[model samples]
Target chain A: MFGLIGKMRAARGQRDAVIDVLRETTGALPGCLSYIVATDPADADAIWVTEVWTDQASHKASLQLPQVQAAIAKARPFIAGFEFQVETHPVGGVGLPASEKS
Target chain B: MFGLIGKMRAARGQRDAVIDVLRETTGALPGCLSYIVATDPADADAIWVTEVWTDQASHKASLQLPQVQAAIAKARPFIAGFEFQVETHPVGGVGLPASEKS
Candidate 1:
């Protein structure tokens, strides 16, 4: 599976705004297995996003969806920068679709 | 929910070995919502572990499980270091249990 793990630094105290924008884009996406938005405990201004998709194309496709695009635009000002963006190949794990649980 | 996102750097040429040890501990952990071990595409010697649990206590308890302890010991030699160990409070997302999806 295709996966992405990254850290997003929010502008000053705007972490919650960034998270809200991300959460707004969370439903009915094709091929999305998991997409979690979380608060980083160590850095009050940082948020972490973890995503898993069926394949690379599916992830790319989601970026083009209007809602996602809108959410990105809405979050831009609140986002200071992104760090540690790592792409991954998920081998197997719990919470994945049965077929992906190998 | 309790969550953790971390990067584990493996000794040169031992990334897969570290991954193997982690994969062996994947099943039947109570309260574990998601536990994914993925290969980092940008760094050959690094891996990312993303996890979500029912609560912090469950995560701590899992560390004491024989299989988890064994896996940690087995993977230690292959692991060079760890970085970006962030604790998070997961809000909502796909692939989380139904009760967790907000």
Candidate 2:
């Protein structure tokens, strides 16, 4: 599985801007199998994103797009902090379904 | 937000048992606002779980139940590995809906 997770804190006034960018750019990515961005309901500043890509190469290519760059730049001013992690998971086993598991 | 996420790998022989327990026990938990269990479609060995509770006290209380214990015990043989992380999320931010966001 191609998984990339990013956790970021939005600036007090920039939550909307970040979410808007996330929603748009992720949808545009070619290999984006799943793009999920969620804000911590309890805290406005905290944001978490989980993305599943077709492959690592496609994911890297998406990062080079102008829209993605623009989105990140626009979000920087309003973002308090951010962390990114990528994991390559092997397939084959019994697991839970999205709706029932989370 | 009271969020408890657990990632576990189930044995080939015991996938059904684990899923059964998760479904049953989560439904019985008193303060369980949300309980999600999902398998990585690409990888059968990978399981991702997301749980949102009313509070830590209630979550801890639920863990003490016999059914929960029995379920975990029964599934232990088939589980390759498991990791648990509980985070206390402070409220007040913009987040995405479960369906639209994911």
Candidate 3:
């Protein structure tokens, strides 16, 4: 599976608004196995995004989805910067189905 | 529930060795709900770790475990540097149980 971990810095005092866009945009991706957005405890203006997709192609394809594009448009103003981004090859874990392992 | 998304950069050629240690260290913690160690597709020297724990306290407690301590020591030499680390308060998602949501 394709995995991703990235950090985003929201505008000061706008973390919640950023997450609302994230929550709304996540599931619209067809191959997404899981998409989680979480608030950073240490950084008041940061959030971490974790994603598991069926494969690299699927993840690439997701960027073209209109919903994802819309979410990006909505969230852009709230984003201060990208802290870091990493693409990963997921092995497996709890919560993800066994099929996700391949 | 607590969620953590972090990225670590391994020594130039040591990402796999580091993950071997990570895989061994995870789940030894009592409150670990999920632990995934994935290799970065973009950077051969990077790895992303995604974790779900029962709570912050449990995650703190795990660091004191003998196994975890050993794993840290063993893996320390292979670490190049940390890219980013973010502590998150997780809501709920596909693999995670609904009970995890507070």
Candidate 4:
């Protein structure tokens, strides 16, 4: 499995708007096991997003999906900057596929 | 619920060692609902850790736990530097509490 952990900063006073856009994209992603959009407790203009994909290819494919592309475009104006994006190999977790004991 | 998404760089070539230490600390956390630790597919010296705790207080209290404190001490040598640490509020998701649809 594949995972992504990142921090996205929204344009001033646009945190909620950015989050709403992200929320709309969840589940709509094929091959995605889990997609979480969360509010940053510390930074008012930040959102923390975590995604679990079946594989790196699926995650890559998601970017080309019309909906995802639309979301990226729609969300662009509200994005201020990204703090960091880290890739990860997901072993197993709750609400994720391959949950059997490892 | 409270959430944390961050990337930790392993000292030099200690990625696997750091991951093993983190794995040992997971379930040992009382209020933690889920903790997913993964290797960074892009960076050889990085590890991505996503955590879900019952509440901010719970997460805070965890740091006071002897086991956690020990783990932190034990894992410190293997850690290089943190890329970014973002706090989050988790509403609902699979294997998480309060999963009923909104």
The number of the candidate with the highest lDDT is 1
Q: Which digits, one per residue and each the tens of the lDDT, describe model 2 over residues A8-62? A: 8887868767777777666557765555455665566777665555567888988
Model 4 interface DockQ: 0.44
Name the weakest run of 10 consecutive residues (lDDT summed) in model 1 chain A.
A93-102
Model 2 chain A poorest ten-residue lDDT run = A88-97
Which parts of model 1 are misplaced by more than 4 Å? Answer: none
The list of candidate 4 runs beyond 4 A from truth reads A73-77, A80-83, A92-95, A98-101, B80-83, B91-95, B98-102
Lowest summed lDDT window (length 10), candidate 3 chain B: B93-102
- Name the runs in model 2 displaced over 4 angstroms: A83-102, B1-5, B9-74, B80-82, B86-102
Candidate 3 lDDT for residue B65: 91
Candidate 1 CAPRI assessment class: medium
Query: Pairing residues by index, what is the TM-score of model 4?
Result: 0.76
Cα lDDT for residue A28, candidate 4: 52
TM-score of every candidate:
0.90, 0.54, 0.77, 0.76
| C-alpha lDDT score of every prediction, in listed order | 0.88, 0.59, 0.80, 0.77
Rank order (by lDDT, best first): 1, 3, 4, 2
Q: Pairs clashing in candidate 3?
A: A95-B95
Provide the TM-score, chain A, model 2: 0.76
State the lDDT of candidate 2 residue by residue for B1-102, as single tens digits: 465545677876565567666666665467665554556555566666655555678789878888878877877787878754435432211122333232
